[model samples]
Structure formats: structure tokens, C-alpha cells
Target chain A: MTLFQQILTIAICAIGTMTTRFLPFIVFFRGEETPKYIQYLGKALPGAIFGMLIVYCLKNVSVLTYSYGLPELIGIAVTAVLHIWKRKTLLSIAAGTAVYMLLIQFVF
Target chain B: MKIKALKAAFPHTIPILTAFAFLGMAYGLYTRVSGLGFVYPLMMSTAIFGGSLEFVTVTMLLSPFAPVQALLMALLIQARHMFYGIAMLDRYRGMGLKKYYLIFAMCDETFSINCTADIPEDVDRGWFYFFVSLLNQSYWVISAVTGNLLGGFIDLNIQGIDFVMTAMFVVIFLNQWFKEKRHLSSWIGLAVSVLCLIVFGPDSFLIPAMVCIIALLTFLRKPIEGGEDKV
Candidate 1:
């Protein structure tokens, strides 16, 4: 691909992405009242969205393969346990990541 | 106000700082090795700030220049952002012109932090969200450029550093779980996603998972919203 085409391709991606990000706001403009259903969604979706995101991050992990996803499993366990025990977000994440790195790098 | 918001926002983005550094550098290195110049990573990282899509764009760039395919791939991968936009519609209102940038920069990490971070009452919400988005994007763009420029010299044993992202999300999910009275939405999200992943596999399960989640949530809205113990 030519340099121009490459830039165009990137621009196309940018356009597509911006569309998804902006579509909801555009559809539910602020001038009119947002429907009750959408309002409920706006409140309720975050919890599920966060959950979906966690799964999205680990989508490629194969429990059937080598290491059996033990590294990811243990990593999540450490993160969840630390957060539940101490309630420090950064501490939980940093420690969990360190443990996972060690596991994948050596133990696994 | 902006300084205060930045100070408040910076701490929340620390994990993203770590995660993006590795991921962005890897992307830059990938771009460099893919026979592209630093310009590609720089442009793509800035224009297409979404991490996964940017990585895919590198491969797209190497292949035949099918603009339609690139656009469709981007829309498919990024369709989740629509959910973010829906969730953030009210939260992002009344921010004037800054809302545009906020929506534009609402990648996964930014959206996660902005959606869940308990901003103090005195701190300005708009600026706080803005700084989080700005800081996250800065980390990504800078790391991508650095990786592309120094692709050959920076050898580090960071095999599982990517797990920081997963770890961060897990923590965020836990935080949300603790905040809510009911775990119905959270459980639905997890179960439906796992089911979809098993059924459709990873590459194609996300949209289905999202559809099923919305459907289930909509179906059970009575119990979820009525504050009844239906879980």
C-alpha cells in the first residue's frame, strides 16, 4: 500500500471508531429527555460492562492448552483477594501483575 | 481546578501507565518490524487510539489496501465503545466542548476509570475525566513512538506484563461489585460472556456476549431495578 493509502486506512479506522464512541450520544441528544429505559441502561450497564471487559482481556486464554490458564487464574485470584482484603486498587493490581509475570516467566 | 483534577486523576491512571507502556511499546516494535517507519505508529496511535484496533491496523497496513475491510473491522472491534457512550451519556453531559474529546478518548481504560472512579466532591468531574483520558492517551502515544524508535535496543523480560490490564479490570470489577447492592448485572456479564466465548470462540464472541448481556439485563430489569432479591 502506498503511504497515502496507509494514512487513509488509518483514517478510515479512526472514523469507524469515532462513530461507535459518538453514536450513543448522538442518538440520545441532551436536548430531549433520555428515555426511562435508556436511563436505566445508563445506570445498570456499567457493572456488566466492566465484567465484559475483564472477559475481553482474557478472551484469548485457552484453558485447554499448556499452562491451562493457571497463570491468568492465579493472577485474577490474587487481584480479587487483595482487593477484597485490603481495598487498595493500585496495590491489588500491581501485586497481582507481578505475581502473574513471575508465574508465566518462571513457574508456569 | 484543572491541576487539582489532574492530581486526582493521575493516581487512578497509574496501572494504565504501566500497562500502556509495555503494550504500546510492543505495538511500536511490531510496527517497526513490520517494515513500517516510526511515522506509522505515531499516526496510527494518535488517530486510532484503540490499542487492539491499532495492532490490527498494522497487519491491515501490510495487507492489500482495502479501506472498506479496515473500516468494518474497526467498527466490529470497537462496537463495545457504543456501550460506553450509552453508559456515559448523562455523566458526560454539561461539560461543554470537552465532552467531544472525552468521548473521542474513551478507550477501555479511560472509560473504566471515568465510569467507576469515586471523584471527590470538590474536584471538578469534567476536568478529572478529561485528565484521565488525556493522560492515558499520552502514555500510549509516547510509548508507541518510543518503542518504534528504540525497537532494537529495549530488550526486557516483560512476558506477562500484559496481564496488568486483566488485573486492573478484575480490580475494577470487584470495586463495582462491592458498590452495588445486587450482583445480578455483574453475574450476567460474566456468565454470558463465558458462555459466548465457549460457544463462539474468542474472536467472535464479544458482540454476541454483548447482545446477550443487554437482552438478559433488559429482560430482568424488573428485579434488578426494583431492588428485589431475585439474584
Candidate 2:
């Protein structure tokens, strides 16, 4: 792809992505009251997001293979222990990521 | 005067900035390695700010997919953004003219930052929130552009990449879990997802688990909270 083509592609994608985020604001309610659907989404969205995030993180997990499985096990273990013992996000993430990478490179 | 906003906004944004910077670097490295020029990563970061979407876009780009395909793929991967906007309607209504920008910038990090903070009694929450929102977007844009530019010269191994996101999620999840006055919903989420993964196979179980988790949380919330505003 040429420079111009790449530039165009990025522009189109940026517009689309921003539009998705801004759709509700653009299509204003124009009424004083909060819309029913928005209210429903407010009630429902947070828990759903939290759930989706978990599934998202574990998206690559598989039970049969050592390729992704063992590393995930190690990650979960390290996360659980760090969470209980130290309760620091950056530390826990670093520890888990280090374990996962080491396992992926070294261990089965 | 605006510097106050930047200072107020930047501290809360370090975690997000760090994550975006490294991930942006990875994407830029991928861009150069895939035979595209430096501008591609910068432009993509500025444009397609979605986390999963950018990763997916790389594969599509390697194949050099058609424009329509890229558009549809962006929509599908970020289908959740529609919901994110819907939930923000009431909160954003007060932004007046800046409402549209709020919608554009509200990613997972932005939403979490918006939702978690206890807006002080007399503070200019509008400005504070706006600055934070803008700061998040700026961090992403700057990191991506810098990474892409740097990608032109640097050559290094970039394996174990996806786990950066995973590690952050696990860390955030753990942080939320420990501090949660009531851990019922998170525990439900964790258990339900694992069970669904075991039962339905990885391909089909996720959405169902999400739905079930929502249902369970809604029904169980009253008892769990004992009628108090936790967040």
C-alpha cells in the first residue's frame, strides 16, 4: 500500500471508531427526561462489561494444549497469590506476565 | 489555568498511558515489519482506538483487506462501543457542546476513570472530566505516533505480546476484587465464565456467560449490598 492509501485507510477507520463512540450524543433525545433505553443500558451495562472483560482476558485459554494452557494456569496462579498477598495491580501484572512469558519460552 | 487540568488529569492516566505506549509500540513494530511505512501506526492509533480492533486490523492489513471489509470488521470488533455510548447518555448530557467529544473518547479506561471517581462537592467536574478524557486520548495518539516513527529504526523481538493486555486486566480485576466491599458480582463473573468455558467450548460460551452473569448479578444485587451505595 502507498502512503496515500495507508493515510486514507486510517482516516476512514478513525471516523468510524469515533462515530461509534459518539452516536448517542449525535442522536440527541431532545427531551427533558432520560430515555428508557438509556436507563436500561445504565442498569445493565456495567455488569455485562465486567463479565465480557473476564471472558476477553481468558479468550485464548485451552485445556488440551500446552501452547496457551499452561501459561494461563501459571498466570492465574500468580495473579491469585499476588492479589491475596500483596494487593498491587502493577506488581501482580508484572509477576503474572513474567511467569507466563518464561513458561512460554522455557517450560511446557 | 489549563495546566491545572493537565496535572489533575495526568496522574490518573499513568497506567493507561503506559499500557497504550507499549501496545502502540508493538503495533508500530508490526506496521514496519509488515512493509508499511511509519505513518500507518500513527494514523491507525489516531483513528481506530479500539483495543481488540487494532489487533484484528493488523491481520486484515497484512492481507490488505478491502475498505468495506475493514469498516465492517471495525464495527464488529467494537460492537460494544454502541453499548458504551448508550450507558453514558445521562452522564454526558450535561456536557452541552462538548458532549460529542465525550462520546468519542470514552473507551474502557476513560469509562472506568469517569465511573470510579467521587466527584467533589464544589469542583469543576465538567472541566476535570473533560481534561481527563482528553488526556487519555492524547496519550494514545502521542504514543502511537512516536512508536510508529521509532519503529523505522528499532528492530527487536516482540513475542509474548498479547499478554500485556491480559496482565493488565488480571491486575485490574484483582485490584477491583480485593477492594470490593461486596465481591458477589465479580465472583459470579469469574465462576460463570469458567463454567461456561468448560461446558460450551471456547467458541460459543462467552456471550452466554456474559448474559448469565448479568442476570445473576441483577437478581443477587439487593441481598449482596443490603441496600447501600457502594460505588
Q: Judged by TM-score, which candidate is best?
A: 1
lDDT of 1 by residue, B170-220 (tens): 887898798788888889988998999899986677668877888998999
* lDDT of candidate 2 over B1-231, digit per residue (tens): 456655666778788888677666655655665666666666666567666566545545655535765565455345557666766667776777666667777777888787676655555666667877888877777776676677666564444544655665566566655555665656676778878878887555655676676577667656555522556
Clashing pairs in 1: none
iRMS for model 2?
5.6
In candidate 1, which residue ranges exceed 4 Å CA deviation? A1-13, A20-30, B1-45, B48-103, B106-136, B147-151, B228-231
Ten-residue region with minimum lDDT total, candidate 2 chain B = B156-165
Off by over 4 Å in 2: A1-48, B1-19, B22-44, B48-97, B108-131, B145-155, B215-231
Models 1 onward score TM values of 0.67, 0.63
Q: Give the CAPRI class of candidate 2.
A: acceptable
